[model samples]
Target: SKFRQADFNLDPLWQIRFDRPLGYFAEILSTIGILGFLAYLILVLVALNKAMILKTEILIFPLLAMLIGQAYYYQNTTSSFIFWFWLAMIAGLCSKIKENKISFILNKETLRGRIMAFVGIIVISLISLFGIFFISRVCFADYFYKQSSKKSVGEEKIVLLKKAILINPYFSGYYITLSQAFLNNALSESQKPVKDNQKIFKLVVEATNSANKATQLSPNWVMTWQTLGMIYQEVLGLVVGVEDWGIKSFEKAIALEPTNPVFYSKLGKIYFAKHELDKAKEQFIKARALKPDFSELQFFMSLIKEEQGDIKGAIKSLERLQVFYPLDLDIIFQLGRLYFNQGETDKAIIQFQNVLEINPNHLDGLYSMALALEKKGDRAEALAYIKKALALSPENQILEKKFEDLKN
Candidate 1:
């Protein structure tokens, strides 16, 4: 009974210790499972060889079961490898059976066996060719879809996405993306003085149709409904009555995904456009509660405040936003205008200065700064700032008049 173990002399490698003992047990079981799987594979291979020799196809059932098991266990691995391996094995077996049959037929009657072999080869070749073409179409469609995202030019992106849709019309995302591109192009065209109303209208119509198609194809998808709502509100609104359609689409989106703040914001914007200030405020408040850091929601909240004739409330909202986005020129300029309206000339001038510091060539900022200086009895500096703004926009008749008046 008398042999004592020397624990102090044991090396770290010799110690059988596990911080997570269950993990160690699991790893050991996994190793044992793998070994068992290897043994099963060897037995199946042996059975397959024996079946082949006996000209019995019964072993195919067990082989297929093994394939199913492998697929289930290794779903994330390269499935193509398994597919090709199984295909090759089946091909080899079929060829072997054909060879044996051909040999037996040729021994009895050579001409019939030769003709059958030729027909079989031609049929297989045709099937393979069709398979390749179908697969290539799918692959090319996926490639174009990916390439569309990499394109910086809107037209090029639209072309690539269209090609993808042409190849794979079942994919709803392609139509949605193409709709967005058309919307962007239409917006760009609308801003030009030499606008093609017909062309813009056609673009908007196409965007609307595409967006509608996407929604129809994926009726349950919230994003598709949201996209359709955007198309109705932003693009179709330029040509037709959009309130009902836009509201319905957005409501559908909200129904599908009630927590999406963007959908609520979009609904609020529609109400805002209709001058339904209370409804707009309700939606905006809900959006703000859901996404407190969202700049657009905050900006819209300030607009609502201003529209409600609460200038001080609007100013406070913007000031709160400035704490998060201090360098934003739009916020700075809006804050300056609010301050000027409240007769806080000094604060207004400081905000305007901040805007000019961020963007020296800002036309509105320069003109506003000049007005603020003039209000403060700094006529010379005000004139200087106006001159700078005039130089930047020399073709503006309004600025030219302002400059002349200031000089007089």
Candidate 2:
């Protein structure tokens, strides 16, 4: 009775609020448990069958990557987490296979063993390759890959990958993979100012050549073009006077994959930087058409439109952006300004209110809200808001003038 009574002092609502985090944790643990069980069952079955049939089976690195990847994906589902998880799973599988584990499992000799063993191997290989493809896509999109510098570990990976490619160099992926390693190294080295540009430049050219080879090997591979384009763009940005070359590279990528929103969006940025508003808008609109849900593209379009003196068009684009990312502070602030520019005080006030609700300390929101109140003849409320704005931005002369005017 005493023990039970002692356990009853917790607040139920506090416990309920705590449950949400616990629930997420439990979900992650449950997923991991299920994957681990599956691995155990599969490995055990393969080992037992090998023992019985006097043969070993290959451990499917790809399948393991997939299983672990799916588990991790469901665990956090973020790109970075997924990247590291997939990376680890792939490297682990490759390491295991390099140690002859895959062959050990697949070499099993049994009437029933051969069928299921090959099936398992095929399934696993597919998942691993898929993981590699997924990782490659991310690398193309972000233009970076993170690899550890532990010589033994990373060398093992490189060696294992080389071995895999040797077994099948006809696959375009082998070239992509080799390119990724170089690209990753180039990226890491590029960040270190002390690192020699000549060395980095050599690596970049090699990476570009490899990526181009991959594209040549598989012309239909959309990812290859993208990667090659990114390499050109990033490396050229570092070495000045390569804008013409960079534009050509982007054009090649666009030609290869015209429908990719990211490709168009990136090209649009390049065009915008070149002061080619019409060309920039063309690419941005194409990107918007392809992926309407891409809020950032709309924002870019808005910026271009505003630069071109199309305030109404800019406002429309911002409105569209607000729908997808309502709490984006920049979007909210921009929408407010756009409305204010058009002399629509009521609409501007609503937009400012939204910003203040999301971020009470927002300087622009506070100042605008105060002005809107003053315009409506609510002197007392307006003055109070002005004081609040001034409190947030004591150095602002505009707020000081408004505050003094209100007092007068």
Candidate 3:
């Protein structure tokens, strides 16, 4: 009762205040619990003979408390075992404190005082352990709380920047460089969104503008120019697809870092968007040569080959893709489409069947299979498949029209 209320609530255990206001009794209970744990922990340490010196025994309680709390947080292990273990430690310490006080009070003379002094040592040992535990837990929680909070804010900024990039794209150096700031903002909450959306937008705009300025300040830094181009293409709402600034940016990046696979990939994306099969293929090939496992580049290469009527070449690229991503439905569907395009209805049907096997309700597979069956003159089965496809995508005008045409 003589203990400060602040001291009572500072317990490592029995202080989980979740509901409304915590009453006075709760605080007393928590304090008692912690003290009890400290006492037991002290006894265990003494029994084990791990006590180095008198000072070290006193220090162990706090150290143990901090260690246990940190280990729980680190492992994210909020199990009952951890909870009870901590509770028991605090209880043991408190019990030891009570026992020492009783023993000291019963005899204060030479024999009694000597006994009291020994008991005092035990109480002090427990107290020291609790102190160490509290200090360590506080310090660790403070440092980690700040770090995790900062990281969370930074991640939010990155997501916002990514969304901004998706929104407009095709502006200039401004938008492109904003992406970098978004990356930095992702590093720290201080650079992230505050309470206001307008402020965040303003910050994003400023970042983009800064990137544009950086390009002007260091025109030779091809990356700066390339970033500027992405802003124009992705953030600025420019009319030009990758063909306009994208091509220029990729070319500039190539001039500076000719062997960079990313530059080649960007150029390939530009060419692909423009339906420039030959050019896209060339750039995609170069990118693949530099980084063979770049699946998107490989996909682009397949796209170019398909567009160029090179069925065999497309199939080879797609086969390699299948090896890399066997479960990708889009790739499977694309492979099926290639077979259908090349008058290989049976092969196309097989691919479509594969898609259905992976996902029975796949509308794309149902539609493709129906078309393939129709081409093979299985009119009845085709009609059934088309009806199922129509059911899956009711609002699809093309599918509806095809379904009607098949019926006719």
lDDT of 2 by residue, 157-182 (tens): 44544554554555676667666767
Off by over 4 Å in 2: 1-169, 193-196, 241-258, 306-323, 326-408
Tell me the whole-model lDDT of each prediction, alpha carbons only. 0.78, 0.67, 0.63
TM-score of each: 0.62, 0.39, 0.42
Better of 1 and 3 by lDDT: 1
Q: How well does candidate 1 score on lDDT at residue 336?
A: 95
Range of the 10 consecutive residues with the lowest summed lDDT in candidate 2: 13-22
- Best-fitting candidate, scored by TM-score: 1
Better of 1 and 3 by TM-score: 1
* All-Cα superposition RMSD per candidate: 13.6, 18.2, 19.5
Tens-place lDDT digits, model 3, residues 1-408: 112233323344422323211442243346568677566456545533443433345545654565455433332223434544554554454444455556556556668777878998999999889866765654454444334334434455444444434443332333444556553452332222233445545545555565666666666666576675555444322233425756776677677656556678878777777777788888988877766666778777787877887889998889889888988887888999998988988989988999999998888799889999999998889999888876666667888888888898
Candidate 1 local accuracy as lDDT?
Answer: 0.78
Candidate 3 versus the native: TM-score? Answer: 0.42
> Residue-wise lDDT of candidate 1 within 1-408, one digit each (tens)?
011122311334422322222432243345568777676556556656655775656546655665565534433224544544554565466554456554766443677767777888899999899877777777888899999989763688889989998998887888888898899889887765357889889888889889999998998777788888998888645776787788899989878766567778999989888888999889888877766666878888898899989998999999998999999998999999989988999999999999999999888899999999999999899999989987776667887888888899
